[model samples]
Target: MPPAQSALVVGAGAVGVSCALQLARRGVAVTLIDRGPVGGGTSHGNAGAILRAASPIADPGIVWKVPSMLMDPTGPLAIRWRYLPRLAPWLLRFIVESRPERHRANADAIWLLGDQAPDAWRRQVRGAPAETLLSPVGWLKVYSSEASYRAAEGGRALYRARGAALEEFDAHELRQLEPNLAPIFARGVLHADGLFALNPRRLVELCAEAAVAQGAVIRQAEVVDVEADDARAAVTLADGDRLEADRLVLAAGAWSRGLAEKLGAKVPLETERGYHLMFETPERSLNRPVVWEDKSFVLCPMEHGLRLTSQVELAGLEAPPDFRRVETLIPMARRMLPSLAGAPTDRWLGFRPSLPDARPVVGPSPRAGAALLAFGHQHYGLSLAARTGEVVADMALGVDPGFDPTPLSAARWA
Candidate 1:
């Protein structure tokens, strides 16, 4: 297939906007479309920390842990019992991905994107107000239990093997690093190269602005249907109008699987419904994003206030939001940070586009040469958006992306 001259990118979240920015920078005419405002989806309600040392969720032995995790009401992982039947196939694939060999491959693939994330972000936001968007204080993961801390050795070894910058801290040192945090932690690990966004939604908006400045068009319309052929790709909006482009990129995050199937790639994409609670703080609380390792939640200090982001509910897209999953974390959050006592000011529920293997589908559609796949980023969409954008742009422009994207290809499911 020839290089695309114009492209239609669906979704205006971090990944889609970043893709539009990269494509526009490469002189491709781009139309970025979304039903909601920029970043209003999962991109808006997240911890906002880009963890370089973070590993894939489907770690080895996770298969054995899922049942207990599902049983625990306060556990980080949850599944709607009614949705279990519908989610069985995806869960089976997830179990397969949790095998040691598959886990290792997925971890390595995740690191490939994570390792290049920071530099790609810098290049993407070169002329934008990056300082206002990003904080360099890094990410902190605190463990409250000795057993949990000990269980993290494998991940620590993985980080060391990957050459990711991280430092371990004793309980006293953890308290010293964040005085506001209670001294309940036994150990802490600081990912020194991590970066956090001050306001995640605004970050996506800025990326869209940057892309528009480069001649990319932003459209607020729902893509009702999509089609692709050897020559061109087109999308039909909810209003009955069709938009055509030389190529089509589906970066629609959680809502991408069906459209990808329409484009001739039947990917086993599932949504990891995540929830977050926002509390108003009169003053700044923490220096950076801090995660409770055992609880699997993060207390991120954002521009708006302190955010308690956590949970992985396995409800489908149409399921009602279960605010209780996040609401139950309040006591734990208060135990971690004594200052977080008042009722939450805001509660948010968003869907994370996840694949069983913990890798995104980031290359060309299997049977449609004119269509590209770029979703299934899972939890690291914000972290890997810039790098994924660069890869998508390179692929669309017929230029080398500098890395083998085989692990992230949808054909693995085929």
Candidate 2:
């Protein structure tokens, strides 16, 4: 296929904006479309950690805890009872991907893109006012029990095998590294290569602004359907308006499955509903992003306030916000940092576009060469957005991305 001269990208979140910026940089006339303002979706409310040490979401250990996780209402993973029937198929595939071999393959695939994430982001924000969003202060994971610390050895080994740098800190060392942390944590692991965003929303807005500055058009519209043939691609908005381009990109995040199916890619995508709580005034300040191992939640300092983000609710897009999940983080946050005693001032829920194998779809559509797929990064979407965008832009422009696209191909499920 020849390089694309014009492209229409659906979705205006981090990944979509990044893709548009990269495509524009490559001289492709690009138009970015989204239902709301840029970054108003999942890209806005997150822990804001540009995680470089992210393991595969499908861990072998999760297979054993699935029963308990499903049963416990306060557990990190929960499923609304009513959604079980619809979630069964995806749950089964998720379990299968939790096998040791599959877990490793998925982790390796994620690391391939993640290892370059910080650099990719650096390049994206270079000379831009939003450069302040990217912080290289690294991420810290704290464990409160010896058993829990020992249990993490396998994950540490995976990071080592992938050549990712990690620094182990005993309780004393951990306290010294983050003086504000409470004395409850027994151990800590620091990913020195990681980066954190001070304001994720601003980062996305900057990317969108950069894309527009580079000659990409920004349109606010809801894309209801997309169609592509051998020659060109077109997207139909909800208002019955249609737009055509030489190439199309589906980066709609959690809302992408329908559009992908319209293009004949039956991706088994599920929404991992994640919640976050923000404190207007934190009693204490954090040096960097820290994850409480036992609770599976993260507390990070952001420009607005201290943000506590985590929880995997296996509910579909239609479900209302379970503010209880956000409320639950309050006590947990206080326990992690006694200084976070203030009441949460804001709460949010966003759908993470997740695939069973924990890898994103970042290549061409099976049904049409004119359409490209770039969604489902799941937990790592923020981390991998820049790299995914670069690769997707390369595919659209017919340039070598310097890596194999097979692992991330949308046709893998087909």
Candidate 3:
């Protein structure tokens, strides 16, 4: 296929904006459309850690652990009983993907993108204000139980073999690194090359601005429908406006399933509803983002406040926001960090686009020749955004992205 002269990218979150930026830099005329303001979705309200290495959500034992996780109120995973019927099919696939071999394959693919994330992110924000948004303080994961810490041996060994810059710390060392944190952790592992965003939402906006400077257009509009053929792709806006382009990129994140199905690819994409609580206590800041592994939440200190980000509810998009889920974890958060006092200043809920195998669909639409599909990063969306965008742009411009994108292809489901 010849390089596209014009492209229509649907979604303005991190992935979509990054796609627009990469395409525009390659001299393609790009139009990015989203219903909300830039970075106003999952990209806006994340824990903001760009990990040097990330594992797939489909760990080998996840299948047996789901039952107890659903029953536990303070557990990391939740499901609205009302939505369980609708979520059954997706859950079944997730269990199948949790087999040891499949999980390892997914982990390998995720690390392929994650390993290149830091460099791709720096390149994406070069000479832009967005560069200031990133922090090199690294990421810390602490374990309160020795059982949980020992359970991670396989993954830790894999990270070491992959050449990740890792350092292990005893409880004393962990307390020494973050003096404010309570000395309750049994062990800590730090990814020395990890990056954190001081303000994740602002970073997205700055990236959009950089894309605009590169001649990409960002429009505030809802894409109600999409279609494509061998020659061109098109979108119909909510207001009955229609637009056409030589190529189309579906980077709409959690809401991308309906649009992608319209283009002949039935991707098994589901939403992982995430919630966060923000406390405006800059005085109680940590040097780096800390993951309380046993509790399954991240306590990250950002520019705005200390954010307690957690939860993976199976509720669909139409379900009401369950602020109570995060609220219930507040006492646990306070236990982890005793300085937290009173109520949180703000709360947020967003949806993460997840695939059963934990690898994102980031290549050509199997049936729609002129359309490209890019979503389903699960928890690593922010971590893998720029690299996925680089791959998409390479596909658009008919250039090889220097790696086999076959592992992340949508055809795996077919």
Candidate 4:
């Protein structure tokens, strides 16, 4: 192995921080750089769901499946036509990936990344409490229409192949499982291995602080550019400070696409804008995270309060947020959780870095000096972030990753 080297990680969200911390632990003096505060990117205010198999969006069927959803105002996934011009290339790749063959391949890679992701998190924190770090409570899926209930078979099979448990329940059994649910619901599915964090932002912050405690330098600086020589790379901050290192890791979440472009690498990257509204405090709402298929939203009893989150908008990074998109969810959230009678004290929007294929962009960047690319994780950032870190560190140390890196390598889009 090469001598202990220095690495500069550009981006301090879950992926960047995790990679930085993991590398530091492996004897690589690490410095994490970010445009804003640590955990300020998409990592800070996600839906907080740590779903094992529920997050990847590589459905080869979704291309055909999205038309109706796009036309309907209340549909779960939406895209603004105005941004369609910019989103054309991304949408094209998305459509092509909708093919069954491509979707399965992508899904397989993501499942591998996600399945053991939790173990990496456990390894990262070293004895973090399960209660504070995890909520083993399984996920519940409630559907009002029989057709929608049956539609789950396709996804259920996919989960089973990926090793997630899918337990079916009749309307009667569903009512028994969730007595508080409205009688309007008919049938349900239990994602038996479901999990979500009690607080995602807190977890990122804790990881960053932990990394700092262990001698990793965490800095607040927006990376404007990166330069590479024959044998090393360096990141240039917005303020003109250039920090040099032997290796570079790019984990900049939604903002990572532009960096890829700057690096002269072509990656089919786009942002899947996600929104959330959290009430003042936990109203002591029902237990577990509920995916209300009928309502196209989820009401999670977060440590702070009920967080109603869901909706995918394909606007480019420069597009302004349609607060109404977040606002539109209020009524449906109330319908899902009857006890949630209060308006949210806070609202937010974050970018879930997405790829044309719905899997993460991982492994080394080939356009320049030694670089590991770990972005485009979309909704699975937190759930898969730590594992990605371990892999990045393993690559830097020239250690076997124990899994194939072909799917995640930056060479795919080339």
- Off by more than 4 A, model 3: none
Q: lDDT values of the candidates?
A: 0.89, 0.89, 0.89, 0.79
lDDT of 3 by residue, 234-328 (tens): 99999999999989999999999999899888988999999999997656668889999888899999898899999999899999898887898
Model 2 lDDT per residue over 36-72, tens place: 9999999999888786745877898988877887676
Q: By summed lDDT, which 10 consecutive residues of candidate 2 come out lowest? A: 323-332
Q: At residue 92, what lDDT does model 1 achieve?
A: 89
For each candidate, give its TM-score against the true structure: 0.97, 0.98, 0.97, 0.94
Q: By lDDT, is 1 or 4 better?
A: 1
Error of 1 at 71 (Å): 2.4
lDDT digits (tens) for residues 124-149 of candidate 1: 87767854788878889899888899
Q: By TM-score, is 3 or 4 better?
A: 3
> Positional deviation of 316 in candidate 2, in angstroms?
0.8
Clashes of 3: 0
